[model samples]
Target chain A: MPAYVVGHKIPDSDSICSAIALSYLKNAIGEECVPARLGELSPETLFILDKFGFEQPELKLSYAGESLYIVDHSDRVQGPDDIDDATILGIIDHHKLGDITTSTPLECWIRPVGCTNTIIKMMYDFHGVEIPANIAGAMMCAILSDTVIFKSPTCTTADIKCVEALAEIAGIEDPQALGMEMFKVKSAVEGTPIRDLVLRDFKDFDMSGNKVGIGQLEVIDLAIFDEMKDDLHADLAALKEEGGRHSVMLLLTDIMKEGSEILVVSDDDDLTAKAYGKATTEGRVWIDGIMSRKKQVVPPLQDSFAG
Target chain B: MPAYVVGHKIPDSDSICSAIALSYLKNAIGEECVPARLGELSPETLFILDKFGFEQPELKLSYAGESLYIVDHSDRVQGPDDIDDATILGIIDHHKLGDITTSTPLECWIRPVGCTNTIIKMMYDFHGVEIPANIAGAMMCAILSDTVIFKSPTCTTADIKCVEALAEIAGIEDPQALGMEMFKVKSAVEGTPIRDLVLRDFKDFDMSGNKVGIGQLEVIDLAIFDEMKDDLHADLAALKEEGGRHSVMLLLTDIMKEGSEILVVSDDDDLTAKAYGKATTEGRVWIDGIMSRKKQVVPPLQDSFAG
Candidate 1:
């Protein structure tokens, strides 16, 4: 079977770009691999795809009977719908896993690094393939997006070093200027509907049996969310019911302020208070010095679901 | 968590010695790991351990909180009972896998090589650790056991080269004579009970969840099984009931003849006939030139179950 290199649901910049970069690396090593995505691309992901002159990967919902090389994430809930039926040829990820069992043995490299592309960079070196300039651009843009220009708590020294080397290969002398251009597209929200904005970077989680949804939007300012707070909360409520979610959370992050204004819609308010440990004034609270949803946000939500 | 390196149930010489060799290599590389077994040792395995002057690894049924580095097998039915609870740090196997899901990313290297010890040797060279004489002897013995001294169908060119290199390191002038000496203990069964002989190298298979048991005995002659056929059949019935097995097959292999006289105790007789495509007389059939049960026997049984 031909290998489909794919990322998890909610196609963030890192997931989409890393899938492309890894698929390129594997193809260079004589593997028949197709890069694919799991969900619709966010604006930041689209910006990277456009800059790298690549089309968005085909959105695949199920991959039964296919040979899969999963990247970016290995969580079962975020995998293709018929994941168990697929033959997992390999897995390369940097996240806490969900229970994904394969019928046969395969290659798996799960590390504690920041971005999946960092692992891909190491593979390119190992295989002695020089990263093409466009693929290097994709990797560099992904590291910047997932680590929030090294501001997110998940960023590691490996990420910092790899991004610099990739920048040199891609002929980008000023990575910070390119990052600002990418974030400018990320912060724009004039013509986009509020519901579309809320769903742009949405991710779902399964804690025990309870289904939870977390949506985050990074902007230079929080007043965009403040103006549409009521509409976004209403949309989140509808999304929770429509998606059969037990709770819904929105992390409106201000990159310049380096903080988040988290909005919650949970059946238990006390559980939310216990999770975040701050007063719920109008169902929102400020979290200082927090940017990583993977590190800071998901753990508390998982604990609250357990409680 | 400290790593617990384990082999499959029914600890054959290859499984036991490979686990010990892998644990040694990991310890040499600064990993805190303990070698473990899943069941009682076969006489052949005991012979190898005593020859190597090594104690038996701890028999472990379950390892809940420890990190696991599974070797020799990846079948969950043959792994620790609480396999899902343990953190899977790595996997090194040379078999078709069972459904084992880990909660985190890990290092997995599964190949179609002849033995797990072959893979361990590759890892030793990759890590620049020189295999000592005794340790190389253990790996050489395991390769001999698994490949049936290069006569089994599963034996590859890699296994032949690896065994020769290991023999040089192990200071064995004539490895063939050493293997014959080892086979002496394997064929000796004057005082061994009928049940103990049957259980000596028995292994179970899970074919789409149906439990199938295959027992093998390699003797210099088959006159022993011919005299004890009725008692062996009765004991197999008891073992099938006790183990909740769907079928039980005993392959009375003769080393001199290089073939097996198979005894069948299946719910479907036609399936067995179709699986082997051989005529049977009173539940016994002589198949010529069959040595490797994994390569030549189990595939047809799995297909019969599929039908």
Candidate 2:
């Protein structure tokens, strides 16, 4: 049976693009490879793939019981039964790895690069595989999405080299121009439901023994923030219920101001105070200068949790 | 006199974050620096800045006769009168330079990197400036916005280094996780006006002697694409009438699929057919593999225009 390349659950651009690019690269090197998605793709992912003229890979509910080649995400979240019968082939990712259970791994290449797309692009370039313009565009977007356009700590030299080479082929003089255009298009906020806005780009993090959810939404009208404040707070409270967590915090971030008003709704004032360096008796804390929940919020919470 | 760092018109994240980060770096290096915005920030940028706890830089409606340092945007667009008595000190940008008369000696640094935030981050690291978590998050978001999280081709090694180092300081384990969250938040589209959706992230390009306008919208639901088709067509037709000698195209792109249904609205069927490689009398071209207007759409149109 052909080895299948499986990405993390909720396949991201990095997972999908890397799988496609690397699968093609591996196939070119005479290896039977298949690109597989661990879950259904989001609309944004579908947009990117459609733009590049690539089909979303075959969706697999679980990587368990199949030969697995993982990308972006790790297998730590998967049950043992999921991968008990599966042979591990290799791993390629930009994220920190969790524990792996595969007994006989054929190859595991985990680089702290900005994007898995960069790695796949390098693999294709190293082997002299000609990437079509559309694939190049997809890979470029994947890299942009993964590294935050090379603003993340995960980016590597290899990632940059891959993007430079790809940029030349793609005929883009400025990626920022393209990105700005993309982001502007992506920022259409007029028609979305309040629930969708609240849940649109949300993530759950284990913070200080409590599952804390962080969500961010962008709006053109800052007045919209003022208008939506009450609704957003109610939504946060609802999210806490839905997530069954100790608290849920939403950052009503304004990109122009370069600052954020932290919206907190929780029972534990101590946790909020420790996490935000301030407390409110109203179960709400407004924090300034708080962005990068991963970098800023997560670390501090980890410290408090550990303490 | 303090050196004013001015960004381009219609300031994006790169322009705003780069201005602030670079100003801080310059101040650290014992230079008088002030961050300045050239225009009103877009809604997405406002979200980022507010999230990071920074005030939006003072907006300068017109740089008329003011000596200023340019970042992200070019000097040419500011017009001769705006830069008349202005001493152009330095320029840090990621775009191709248009024709501009430099009155004073300029230390223009134009790299093909993904974002000006990457450049600003590099300066911060080079000068050994400590990045606050807020600044780091802002820069990271800027990079994510500019490079589409490193999926754009314009990213460079410097961009990767800045992001990697910043990510570590910001304490983010995986920037992609954050990016995915951000993009998801950004992709929500429920109540946005069809006109606003069409123009939110719109750009114009000269393709094969025909000026072409391209717009993209990131919506959470795929059904919206189908729902808005008729409105979009009517809007495009109206847009064409109120335009110069050019065609308009919109990509209701599904990012997950990395593909797009390229909608072309043009009176010139020949130009449309040549650009899309097929002629449809309906004035709409469905391109299977076209994303990145710069790479996939613009170049082909440029070639066809030239031909």
Candidate 3:
């Protein structure tokens, strides 16, 4: 069987685009790989795929007995349920090293970059493989999405340079304008179900055996979520109880304003206060300059949970 | 202080040379780094360093409050005692992914190659840094030592290509002859202390919280250790007791014979049978084509322990 190139659960643009682009590169280098996703794509991801003239990857939930090349994640919590039973052929990620152990040796290309696609682009260059224009477009948009259009603190020079190169290959003249267009699609919250909004960019973490779920919604303005905080909090509470999670958080991130309004629902009342040193008022708190969840939020929460 | 690049305890040629060569590459890229050894180097490593006109790295036991770039290892058990207190700047390894998690994003270049020096060589090329002849010579010797002169099962095409490139840089006409010369030095077992032999390439593993120590001696012949097996077993027993380890194993690997005679001194009597599916006589068992402790021995033992 051909190896499956898969991404994390609750697939983001970087996760989806990385799987596709990396699978293309691997096939170009004579490796039989099929792109797969663990969950449904969000509006932003859908927009990027449609704009790039690409089809959504096949959905594959369980990975038992399959050869997998995981993309965009290294954490077990973010992987398929039976990942332990699967043979992980390789891992391409851009996050902190997570608790995943393989019995045999495997290929790994993990870096402290802004996006996995940036590392994928470097791999393409290393192998001297030319990326297709549509795939390059998808990869460029993935970088823009992950780095918050170069406004996020996690954005590095490598990410910017990759986006520039990918944009040239993709024939995109105004990448920033395209980024705004993608975020505009992501900002469409009206008439959307509360669960859909919360689950759009959700991820569950296993912090010291305490399951914590976090979701983010990036938009040009925070006022779109101002009137919906109560419903979002109710939905988060239901999600926390349904998943038996210790806490469920939703970050209403205003990309232009460069901050986030966090709505937290937890079994413990002081969860936010302990993790961020900022007390929550009715399970809500506003933090300045908090943009990246993988960088800014998850680390502190993981440390707090460990302590 | 510059970031210290160190390898696993009981340093071998690959461990020592990878640290030195990677530190040199980092320095060429304007990153200040110092090569360090976690423990005493083996005779093989010492020979390679001396032949390449390089000094031995400084020994450092504790890593508390220091910035570290780990080479050839990712497991916490094989790292410094206070590694949890230190900041791990990056990891460059060729082993299975061990249980090590970082809170922040870090650079990682792990591959299923035969040697860490091969991966470091790729890093040098990736950074467009020219490796010095001395470092190239040391790296080539390290690869030869780890891959058993291209006879190991862990050896890959990448490793062979890297050796060819490094041999050109280091002016090595016959790489296999140099490999044989290094093995002759490694095969010198006469007049060596029992403790020094056992501790030469030893490594401690935390298997389900049960500390298991394993060591390997790769030589051109196994007959050299026939008369010394009893003393080695006694020393392993004492070492196990002193360190409170559940087991201590030594692989007398015959590189030329392409096999190993395993001397296991474990708390349990059936460890060899359970781990390798082979019956042992007086804590000794022979297995054909078992030259790599990391590949052939450790994985099965780890799985058996986990079970």
Which candidate wins on DockQ? 3
List candidate 2 stretches off by more than 4 Å.
Answer: A1-307, B1-4, B38-43, B75-87, B155-161, B205-212, B219-222, B243-245, B276-281, B286-289
Candidate 3 deviant stretches above 4 angstroms = none
Alpha carbon lDDT of each predicted model: 0.81, 0.65, 0.92
List each candidate's DockQ score.
Answer: 0.31, 0.01, 0.82
- Candidate 1 to truth, TM: 0.79
lDDT of 1 by residue, B179-241 (tens): 777777788877778888778888888886889889998776789666789988888888889
Candidate maximizing TM-score: 3
Candidate 2 lDDT tens digits, B169-254: 77787876676666666576558777776776666554434556777664334465777788888898778777674788877665
Residue pairs in collision within model 1: none
lDDT of 3 by residue, A47-137 (tens): 9989988899999998888998999888999999999889898899999888888888888899998999999999999899999999999
lDDT of 2 at A8: 65
Model 1: per-residue Cα lDDT at residue B259: 90
Q: What's the i-RMS for candidate 1 in angstroms?
A: 4.1
Assign candidate 1 its CAPRI class.
acceptable
Distance from true position, residue A199, model 2, in Å? 69
* Residue A191 CA displacement from its true place in model 2, Å: 80
Deviation from truth (RMSD, Å), model 3: 1.6
